[model samples]
Target: MNSSDAVDIATDALVVIAKISAPFLLVVLAIGLIVGLMQSVTQLQEPTLSFVPKLIGAAVVIALAGPWMLDELVGFAHELYQRTPQLLEG
Candidate 1:
């Protein structure tokens, strides 16, 4: 395929990746921020304190959103596969 087709495929793939990971990333970010604030206020600078909550939050988010993420990924893969013939001919 030409440059534009390649770019389009790359863009689609990136979008799918971002969409799939966003929930986990956002949950982790929120947890980290909250834990950081708590640490600052309480003067408890234990590294593992922050890690555990963020880990749990990420796991919870993933458990809750896993099916939706899978669906999005599957849809993207299906679309890409469907476009393979056109991409090949280009």
Candidate 2:
């Protein structure tokens, strides 16, 4: 494909990646912020304190959103596959 088609495809892939990752990223951000605040208030500067909670939060969010993530990925793959002929012909 030409440059524009390649750029469009790259943009679409990035968007799909962002959409799939946003939930987990957001959860991690929120948890980190909260943990930071708690650490500040309690003056507990344990480096490992945030690890488990963030991990657990990430896991929980992934677990909850796994199906939706899968659906989005599947849809993206399907769309890409459907566009293969046009992409190739470009």
Candidate 3:
């Protein structure tokens, strides 16, 4: 309804997005570092070497956290829905 409310919604949405993305991002970053280290140790400088591990790591993170993430998203959606009328009134 106003700039402050809009800003609050945007901030909340960004926080949720960061929370949801952090695990996968961290997993991929870790896997990438490990793969890079291994590549350096073996001296096989293959660019694609990092992709599979990072992808797999991200996939595993998604598999492990998918349900919880979905629940969080759904809860946020519900909250937005519940607050819709109030926001409209404001």
Candidate 4:
């Protein structure tokens, strides 16, 4: 309820966001790098070439780790909910 509590909640939210997004971002980054390298070697500059792989990589990451990400978010929400009474009383 106070500034410190708000800061703590904000920090926790940011951590959860980073944790959930890391996999997808990393996968996309790696895929994009590889695609870029391939394009450089092949001397082909096609926009879709880079776009498709990154998209697929992100989709695959979501498909594989979606449940875990959802669990993380749900856990954070549950924790925040549990702390509601304490926060409100402050």
Clashing pairs in 1: none
Clashes of each: 0, 0, 0, 0
TM-score of each: 0.94, 0.94, 0.95, 0.96
lDDT of 2 by residue, 1-90 (tens): 789988988999999999988998999999999999999999999999999999999899889999999999999899989989998997
Which numbered prediction scores highest in TM-score against the true structure? 4
- Give residue 25's error in model 2 in angstroms: 1.2
What lDDT does candidate 4 reach at residue 75? 100
Clashing pairs in 4: none
**Runs in model 2 lying further than 4 Å from the true structure:** none
Off by more than 4 A, model 3: none
Model 3, C-alpha of 40: deviation from truth (Å): 0.8
Those runs of model 1 whose alpha carbons end farther than 4 Å from true positions after fitting are none
**Full-model lDDT for every candidate:** 0.91, 0.93, 0.88, 0.94
TM-score of 2: 0.94
Model 4, stretches more than 4 Å misplaced? none
Residue 78 of candidate 3: its Cα lDDT? 93
Output the lDDT of residue 64, model 3. Answer: 98
